[model samples]
Target: MLYNRASLTNEELIKLYKQMLLPRLIEEKMLILLRQGKISKWFSGIGQEAISVGVTSALTHDEYILPMHRNLGVFTTREIPLYRLFSQWQGKANGFTKGRDRSFHFGTQEYKIVGMISHLGPQLGIADGIALANKLRKDKKACAVFTGDGGTSEGDFHEALNVASVWNLPVLFCVENNGYGLSTPTSEQYNCEHIADRGIGYGMESHIIDGNNILEVYTKVSELAESIRENPRPILLEFKTFRMRGHEEASGTKYVPDQLMEEWAVKDPIDNYRNFLIEEKILTPEEDEKFKDEFKNTIQEHLNATFEEAPITSSIENELNDVYKISSPTTIAPNSTTQNIRLIDAISEGLRQSMERYDDLVVMGQDVAEYGGVFKITEGFIEAFGKDRVRNTPICESAIVSLAYGLVVNGMKAVMEMQFADFVSTGFNPIVNLLAKSHYRWNQEADVVIRMPCGAGVGAGPFHSQTNEAWFTKTPGLKVIYPAFPYDAKGLLTAAINDLNPVLFFEHKGLYRSTYQEVPTDYYTLPLGKASLLKEGNEVTIISFGAAVHWALETLEQVSVSADLIDLRSLQPLDTETIYNSVKKTGKVIILQEDSLFGSVSSDISSLIMENCFEYLDAPVKRVASIETPIPFAGNLEKEYLPKNRFKEELLQLIAY
Candidate 1:
């Protein structure tokens, strides 16, 4: 099949030819560097440069773009330094990643280019989020995200498409179909011939174009981008191209046929566009040669200047720099005043007070506004704060978290809720990449609180029942908190809201309705990174958190042994002073948790005790936790699987030691 060359302008045809030539030359030089071992690895968008440059040139610079790893042409056309790009490929600090991020993760905030998160389809959800923020701010900016045909198979892709359509977000999903995902062909991956067919299921408009034709790519992308900006709807585009080389430097095209390679080489986009330019009389042979020489010299000068300068180096001290904006220590004093309040009431009141104090705070999630959330944690918030401040989002976990990250980045304090802790994994990419590492990567504080209901005791079963604190405790730049009673819940949440970093507020499903010590009616806050001593004893120290604290307290009363009960409020910053002091007083220690034993918080606590308080201990630290298996659906098995009588038995053994 052939396309007519009479429709396009001569200058536009010549420009497309020049763009393709530069990227091809740049990739050839990179392949040479890779072969010589000057660069460790490289991924080239060799045969698919037309789609990248054409689409990027069509969009406005003020708009946001989330390009994938194979988008060097887009970045180059956007005026990202070629030298910096090469330096990044060589793992130098002079690259945009500051010597920390990989080559594909390049981005500059000044260019309105949101960084490319390496995760496959998760960036699609985040692109919708950026568009959502722009809409909320009344800014006329659209978001464009690039992904491969192989990525459409991921659940996140479908999830993001659904949400973008539902919310009418100004986002464009570009699918660059380069024929293969590494060695696997598209025929083996999906039954559908084109990825654009899947977009129909989500009620989105889609297009399929010849990816090798720069004129076609540019014309289609320009129209779709403008249409999305005007109507604020999502668009899905499928660009059909071929992979001329291996997927990456490590992969070889041994399985590919020589005939197929020769066939694609004959239809090279750059050569085709060059012929179109000559047919249109855009340039003579002498003029074309001059243009090629000028571009090569300009690129060489940029590369020379970039490589000659000193590169940024990584250091151990830099790791400690961006966790939080550490200001001069401000003294905080706890109020002695007290009043009675219920657990649920305390949570609602704390949110009210925080919202009243900070105008930047915005709360959103599934059923958070109109229905007041599933657990009623956000009850009466919409009526009190108005719709702009309190929003109800569709049941899209990944989109909800990604939108929260966008809001926080734009100087808004965001509080998002996961319907249940088990669903948090759906949004794990943005939570780990954007929220957890925002400050660490760009020295930007992300004030976001993710409220999730966790723990199993009310028969939520395997799907609904899960304790995920252990999953994020090991992650840097995240503060995990679990409160036992109403007072701590209110105070700790308030403190977390005030923090300039991301915090995971895990509320126990069992403790939400359980009666506990009352909280004060007046506004107050509790300092984070501190533990409460429920009971003081000398025999053994029993440390626990959240609903497990209640079990530990009950076991201490039943047994004749007097034990020290310490409630750990903050999982990330463990109260070392309080824990060590209790361990010193009692030579024996028992760590109790409701989660599985493998890689749980109990393991970290036990290791900490052995490392810091080993000399003061008489017996080895014992851990009492749920069995290392999935929570069963049956009542009897679930009861047996949970750490019930085990805590008492472990405490007794430690005390008797």
Candidate 2:
């Protein structure tokens, strides 16, 4: 007999019972494998099967979900092959991330599941993006993200909640209040009565439930999911439960009190739910035992097959595959006819044209909508694209970037902006880890353009004036584009937007309205990793990017010596062919950058010249860059700190040598 209130057929109840049992039994088998030196590691979700199974069963397959390591039931309920799960834990190549990332630290598109990163909170921000996508497309899909009681403490949690509430997007924040974050107790983790209280702070509806009761969890989540789909609002659900096992297999339960464990042991979700089924006459004890045996036997078969499969065999060549889907090498030349526009206007034109071209392209940032951004780069964007496409986000840099990654995960392209380049420190994790590494880890495309307004010249001081390109250039799986002229700015912005990977497009703040060049207005993409030869001569090679390229141009006019002046439009993929050829002919080179000398992009150029062009060198390679001290507010001191005054001196010395 099926429960009358639930309207669940006997088969659905039986299936839920089986789904919960499989993860528990599989974890038991995995624990044995871990001890026998077969699998490397495991995180046992022995007591938390119901939460995963119940919540996942409540939502439809189309609704996206982000889960954690303890969500083994989620994978099982979604009907992912048991072999893949076992193979994944064993780091096999057939695993979701091809053994690149272990456990639930990977997203599988087939299952519509995006697993969490080690840093718990960012997933919530990604949830916001997925929810926003659903809202814009009118898909009636409520996005859900899982977190522990401890994960609610992350700033991303607050940021995501606020945005979801403000925009009335369809999202469900599911917190399995397992009473501990690692070894930290709930008493120590927060001062609130429940994680659900955070919902009140965000003006979102909140609920608490007995997580050990599978029927209650299923009923509540089903109702909430339906409501979110209908009304398109965010909700927070805090399921109060206990961690009957240690956080992971290696961490023992000693940190948990003996009394607490004894209390929760009797309330084990699977055991209680089985007893309830027996009371309803829906299942018999003999049948429950039979079900366990059947699941165990099936799990064993998959485990045997998985273990027979060879573990991941890796080498440098294998590991290096798919780090990035780099921007294709474009051979098409721009239109011969052009109009003069400022560097910032060129950026605006490129963005406008791309928006006109791709309907799904989204532009999001702070003060970017009605206010036109701090520098007015996004002026009149709302009027052109409307609010859905042109979104003005909260001042949360970290979540904003992760949100863009979330959109990319759901088959949409995002162009996010940082108000100031120096502020990128807050959002570095998503850029370097999620966006940059997604393709390499799980083949998830994070096709995002993060526009960074960088460089020094105006007396914006340390917070606003910074050339932080070196940080991203050193990171693999990222394209760093820094264009010095308005033409390259418009052309490369088009290219960065077209790239299938994450791109950090650096716009020198000083050059936004300061310089102008004739640029094509139509949609066109210049080749990435290609540098422009502004002036070609043989006495010296003066290579620079961003604002310093202009200074190099001016310094060339001061000197009588003929030099090869090259502007690096893209930083990560260096135009080495152009640099090497020029270095061989010029024999002497002086690298210029607005960033500090040590550990800068210029440092890499200097080394490359010495290594590849050493035999042809006429003098030692010199570097002109900012002083070691922080940028000062005084105009004169700022000029002294930068390469504006130093590039000419370095070029003259190289020429004299």
Candidate 3:
């Protein structure tokens, strides 16, 4: 705590000390509530208060900070009202997450605080996105993102570091190495000499800080932040601290050695800072005692008030509306004239006109820039837009998707292009847990479109050509779109780009070049979740999307009965109205899809028809899809494995029955 520090006045020093003390007192009371059964859980940051307080006090309140589970000091230091924080703990309606999440799991926009998810490393990538947005806007604002020693082992840690350094985004990645990651010691977490050394490898600067020393941290981080904002780039700071409590209250600290606790307890940040203040005659002993008493009483007062607020009432209707925002694409501003194009060209031209229409639309993926995508959907994007908007990311799928979430957190919308749809499995956690649940858990809208080029026919085999719409259509928050033709591709993608929720747009590799249509080359969008009625007949109905629709189209012509062919442009927000009406009109029906039969979109549609339109059927429903096996590489095996061969037989059986 003793150093020739920066010129922080005695008044500012006392304020910082008090800020550190407030969270300690708040947690102390919350621990009491936990014992009394008023609160279910409490993640106490009792020992490591100085890092959050000191680092936060140094940065401007308008700049963003992503706090970890133990960083209550960040909220208090930024003057986030105590009542709301207490409400969060009690699952009250007034909390930031509307009681959807507990403890420091929620972040408040009022304080520019971005709360981290359970998987900590992803937030680091998201912080990079915020820094990227700030740099693009020339806001001169920097961000402070925190992670733990255990989090350093995640692939996202390496991915985020490399991206931030290469892009030179202004971010202070503060790692609180508290010796253990839930009983795993720092010795096992990494083999390096120091965590700070990893920063050098990423071509970023590094610093070591004493986590318990309030004076040292405030002065050092204040200087570090000023330097970063002036010349934008990332710098890593390793704060050596100790977790005085368990990971959460219930997970006891028995794994942490008694000797280690004794060593860190002696370096208590609040006790040390208060003693230094008294030594310098900056504060009397009476004032120190008074500050403690005041904080204790203030926290109790807020706790009592928090209990008075209503607890979140359970309601399915409330949750029904929570999963997605109502669609409104009219707000988009881009415009263009008409042109005839291939399905692949419509995709390219749609994005070109979309970028022209929407200034905030940023396209990012591996080899997407100069090389174009592997499919060339983003061809000439780099030349058309600058490198900043047309970003070519490192091969880090998880980090790339999370970074898009970060961009959308700011005002910008992003187009996250996966070189292949099968590769999305790498980013599943962030998408399903973070992006999909974002709107349902919180009111925030994730305005980004994830483009996945999928489907079989090019013999890309199991790893690349699989159509996995079932993976997302079942997920509540995401909109899954799969188009079969050129015109539908541009319209649905534009709608997805303009959508306020996270969207999964699937493009068929088979249809990209093979299918051609004269389309409106302007910025336009078709109805999302609305099926295109390609043909109308009274005998039987066929519902299909993506490449399988073409197969269904060809197969239905061979059948005796006239059929209603529905090209379902999107999977989720499934045009239930169109589906139900079509099924009622024609008693016999078949649901066709490129994906395998087991647990696929076809099965769900079968269930939907059975549940809603069961009595309308003259015969049993049929599903025609690929066989339930991994796609074969042999060309003949691949040809036999697809749904096209079965569709004609299935459609004729339904009509004959």
Candidate 4:
């Protein structure tokens, strides 16, 4: 053993050195595999391994890490098994995700590392939520999130920093400034002198260091990590480094200058650090050679073992099985009485019941606390649950959504409300990309409910009212529900809160007080994915959801046609069996929708009828939907845009046909 050391002993320094070297070697092997068509793609931070090792080494084992794809040294520092990494690259059954994901896309709960998505910038906000959980537990733990200079340009980067700063979360923001974001130089990307400057703008104490120096990287990060664990404030750390290889082996270095590559290659982190170890006599030349050889041989053994395994096979049934978690039915109390409640009040009651049931349930969004949400759906919740459980966030929608995802993954439940469904565009990334894909990707349940107040007839105009259910219907992993009645709204919201997956619960703004009924006062849950048969008829089947269901009911009374009115409470996991049977019985169908005609849910249901009930149809399926245009602000134009008259005319036309 050697004696002279700075901050870390000879053993630890040597260990860090070896950890950095192993990833470089593994990446080199991955390149070979790529050429042989064994692996699909490769992204390497060849010259910047010191940042991952230095930062991750400072974190305690259980403190979470939201690493980017290039941070392979983090997995090494955390002692992730090399064979498992190899198996993932080889698409073998022994991989962490059982070959469901590829390289840098598998996370292990045991390691506290979140598997990275392709769009990595959003993870910074996710890390904030993980840190928030630790803070809530008062566990004195912290999180370190990795991103690149290019990633800093993403809106999520700004949104995350703002939320972390405002919440005083214990998050270590590590930005690796590799000079380029997939060939776009930093000069062209941003006007700021340094990415760390942006963090300072968000109220974080910022630092910049030479990423090539392992000792400097470790010393600064270790100090800040401990400081934040004690005081619980975010720290922004910038590591200036260069990517020593192609973006991937296939995406060649033609765009990168040879002179610059040669300059950075000579300053390769592993080679320079190895020299530092030998020059300081921390390791003898012979010891260094033996260490490199041993690691290389171990990596070779892992590769061989991983390649010998077969790829995991998947059937359509297996893939679909994980789309949702099976919920045990909850029986409503037989002695409970129905109370006269508005739709909005019923939603508040459901929130109260779910929060009272689970201590870890969190309610957060703009104006949710104190202000009781814009629609008053969470009125009195802050008084009942306290500010700790019901939080009013800044207008950072992306952070709100992604942070909820982070909380759910850590065993807490979250109900995030979008003040208006139109603004969901701000948080669309996490909803579709992260929340919806979490279960399908890693069997990780994001027990999150996003409450959206939707519809056009509310006269809230374009920015506040939009029927965007069609957007989520295209996404596979989300459960979309739009309830028309107070009872259905309360029941569906309760069920969504208890579900072990992400759910988009759309509450129609127009139906908030336009209709009221007796709703169950006690805690209960309705089955998700089942439609309610409101009326029975024989001539034509009228199917709809949300505010349009009521319109269909009213139109049925005006028309002199016999029809069956079906309220489709859930848009996805569609009650297709109910719809098919109804169409078969009626022999003619009219699907009503409040959303625009272009790319509407009615088109999908119409197609399903055509595919399954073609022989039973007496005429072509009819769709009554709003005109394909932005919602008009004028009351008269808005009324004209609705399809109420069209529904009656379509019913008469289909009857005649």
Candidate 5:
């Protein structure tokens, strides 16, 4: 069942058999290394090598490959040095990531192979973006992104597939249905009878193939890749294969049923293809044995050479080298203006001014170019900047973030917008692994701006409303900023753009149209890691950011309490100097956020203050945030769940004490 009835010539069959044997031998070597403790871990493609080799053979060497963790066969067939792979496994200096990234994260841009991202299903969106860029440049290259059957359950997979199909991008999505995702099988993951059936929802051409059949896989993928490269449409190839080993080296085969393993063993891709080759007289029994022996000897020599080389151990020093690409001498300054401004306009004007100042700034997102985005923050950008700079992208968050990374790596300042902050999870992998840590990992700076509309209110349901600042702020090497007023927005955003590190610019949707203030026409910048003191008071220090700062200010006005209000514009590089100084001056403090109090940014600030400024505190630091529940759709329930504007009342009670 693993082989097709179509006949192949002696030479063609020989090639297929050889390719399969190479991966099989390599996998066996890796498993031996793992058992000997020479390698840290192993994620083998033993039973699935046919599909991997076939897919790689179908594409040109110049085409891009964005593979998942189970892609050893693809890399091996592409002539990736076996020693370099062994070095990576042993955590050596000559490893693909220079010992900084994991084994599966290796890639070579010179070989036209984009870096591997291990996050499930996210790479598909990135592949779409790469294909789109090729289309824009009128390049003939196509992109292939591989994943597993379980990856289809992720939201990013659907988002990417829909966009690719709609835009007709030259992308091939290959899903290797290996039956198990760790312990959860494909039957438990989806309701569809076949993985290819889900492709209909995206209006893509789908194919179901015997993943064990190398010849069939190569022919089918070659035809699809060529067709999409010419017509530029999305194609989904679902290869039904089986995993011979457990998920990883750490996982034993105890969870797998004996009967299923036995059945799959009989259909071993390597052995079956070997039999096919001998039966067709493509390879004599002696020739097959000699070929394997030679291959094994070569792999053994490479493994020894790789192990003899010293392992990479100096990753700490390398982490500091790529924080920012262009180190501008200019540091941002704090805003001294007494005039107030709204947050939304500040972001728009900040982007506008930044684009005008720098010709390399490119902005893209859903409805960002012509529709001005869902918030109309970028409404007139297309008219002023033209289509090249201000472009509208398909609703593919993963692709959007990955494209931004690619552009930034090639000397462009990419400003990407996520229609809403809640949907950022769709692109979380690219942002966290690629954007946030690319500079740290690759010794290359990724200067990109991610603008996200966040926060709750206006009766938007749980899916639409969320304040996930804590998620990004927790990640190191990334700068996070949330401006409350127009002045702060313009200043902080300008600072973020000027920063060499990746910055997450979060804008509260509530302040987009409702809150307005006078912004300066002149250029101004705010310093990173500096907090804005809205009101200086001696009684208590009320620390907040984004929309909460405005609420904190209004509360002070109503309560008539002299409170020191600190607007923490930059979340990652916390302004400890300002916070400690204020906490030292005012013994009491109140931390506030639109997110839930538990594990919120406010909680982090409270911990910082308690750890560093505990002796100076007059009372325990209090926190006020939304209830620990999903945002409700009804107005009354939402209002009850969110932080009320009764901070003044609470402040009065504290002041009376």
Candidate 6:
């Protein structure tokens, strides 16, 4: 009752047989490599080869595929060289990730494939964004993202599916229900009758098929893919299959019953398909045996050469190379015009100008459409750019951040705004793990600017009020920008959008209306890693950023102390030249930060000054920062907790010392 072999031509039937046979041979050779001590680990798809081969063969090569670690057949079907696969498994320097990552954790832009992280479900949202980009470009291409039955339990799966369904994006969410998630069975994971049925709640077209039936899988998924390309919509496909071996070679078969293994052994997809091919007269018995022998020999050759190749040699110094791309400062004309603007207006104007300059720029966040965001920063953007460009996403922080990688990798720049900086915790994995390490691993550009509305004084409480720049300062490959003045906010943000790296732009909610400055009317940019010298003095150098800069400036005015004030616009790439020069002039240094005192950016700066300018110090570096507790809800408690007055006290004490 499945797809009939009589419905296909002899050539099509032969191609299907070869596709299924190749991954099976590849997995077998991989196991041999594991025993020979060439590969450290192997996550094989022995029983699930039909699903990978069928699904990949259904789609065109131009359409993108975001595959999991077990889906090596997708790479093989894409015609990736056998040498690269063997090299990657052998940990040779010629692998796709240059031996930086093992197994299937490598992809190239030329192939339109983005490899998976250890966390599986985030790629669903990334595929959603790629589909969105295709829609923007009016391309009739769809993307397919794969995951296992256990991955459905992740929150990213639900968020991505919901968004794809809502926007009618061309994404195919495939769940290879292999009966078990590691050691746990399906009954323990979900209560649903079938994983495919869950798609109905999201209003997506759903299908469930026998995964071992290659003809059925190829026919159904190919039709569904064509439908998705013609009219953009998500399709949830669940393939019911089982893993023949244990989770890994090291895992014994004690967990799987002998009776279950026997049942699947009789129904082996390769054996059944070969018999079908003979019955249908597609190939003679001798021809089929010769075909398989040829593939086995080819795989053996690649495996043999892979062992002869040199193992990847790397050092700690190699890791320090590609954290950030070297980008020059933006050039501004000498006669550029200026206009007075508020801090928030300057930020909004910068977003507008960047969008005008780049055709592929998208501005997205929660309540950012007609509602103009919670802070009204994007009030009129929807009218100007339309709903497609100015998107209003749901309150799913992880998906919002995950989509940025998908957009940027597909020839687009994204400006993502978090409703509040405190909510960034929900999306921390992709931000720190994936986006930050993208360029370092594969030399891909993550051109994204994540706008974070941070800080206290608005009585928004802990959930809404937070300055989380410290959390990202330790992460490599991310540029952190926290501007105090309106001019710097506009200039820095503009430069961040244009730069070829991931940037976290922190804008304080308190400074949105309080700060005012004459910003440029047209376009201009300030260089990153360059600190602004606000007030020059010879006694002590006070280094700060964001709202803390204003507090330090106010304290300096009231104390009448001759102290050098430095506002660090960019935190990650610290302005060592400016800080060292100022330390030479003023022998004393005081670091003031508004965040919690423990593990603060101020602590990092203080340590840097101590290590680099130890001789220039007249006294040990002093740090004045917030108390080590949550920002309080009450107005009086919040004021006492922040204690901006402490800056003046700390400054006066340091001067006396």
List where candidate 2 sits over 4 angstroms from the true fold: 1-5, 326-333
lDDT of 4 by residue, 1-657 (tens): 122246687788888888788888888877777888887888887899989998998899999998887899999889988988888777777777756778888677889999778887668888988988888888898799988888888888888888899989999989999988888889999998988887768878899988877878887788888888899988888899999877776777788888988988877888888888888888788987897788889988988888787767988898788776655656454226889888888888888998999999999999999989888878888879899899999998988899998888777889999999999999998889988888877778888999999888767777887889999999989999999999988888888898888899999888888879899888888888999999999998999999989888888778787888899999987999899999999999989989988788999999999999999999999898998888887888888888866777887988899
| Residue 48 alpha-carbon offset, candidate 6, angstroms | 0.6
Global CA lDDT computed for model 6: 0.87
lDDT of 2 by residue, 400-430 (tens): 8988888888888899989999999999988
Report the alpha-carbon TM-score of model 3 versus the true structure.
Answer: 0.98
| Model 4 TM-score on a 0 to 1 scale | 0.97
Per-residue error (Å), model 1, residue 409: 4.5
Q: What TM-score quantifies how close candidate 1 is to the native fold?
A: 0.90
Tens digits of per-residue lDDT, candidate 5, 400-516, equal 787776555445678889989989997888888877766656555667889989888877989888989888887877888888878778877887888878889988888877788
TM-score of 2: 0.97
Question: Alpha carbon lDDT of residue 93, candidate 2?
Answer: 72
Query: Which residue runs of candidate 1 sit more than 4 Å off their true CA positions?
Result: 1-18, 309-312, 320-339, 352-362, 385-396, 409-413, 433-447, 498-500, 516-525, 557-564, 632-639
Minimum summed lDDT over a 10-residue window in model 1 is located at 325-334
Clashing pairs in 4: none
Tens digits of per-residue lDDT, candidate 6, 1-657, equal 244764678898889889888888888878877898867998878888788888899899999998886787788888887987889776687787767787888778877789888888778888988999988888999789999999999999999999999989999999999878888889999999999989989988999988889998888889899998999999999998888877777875677778988998877888888888888677799998898899998988887777788878877777677677666755653226888889999999988888888878999999999999998999999888999989999888888788878988778889999989999999998899888888877778788889999999888888888898999999999999999999999888889998888999999999999999998888777887789999999999999999999999888778778878999999978898999999988999998888998998988888888898999888989998889899988998898888587788888888889
Answer with 2 or 4, whichever has the higher lDDT. Answer: 2
Candidate 3 per-residue lDDT over residues 77-123, each given as its tens digit = 99878898888877788787776887887765668888888988888
lDDT against the true structure, each candidate: 0.81, 0.87, 0.87, 0.86, 0.80, 0.87
| Deviating ranges (above 4 Å) for candidate 6 | 1-3, 314-318, 326-335
TM-score of each: 0.90, 0.97, 0.98, 0.97, 0.81, 0.98
Candidate number with the higher TM-score (1 or 4): 4
Using lDDT as the measure, what is the rank order of every candidate, best first?
A: 2, 6, 3, 4, 1, 5
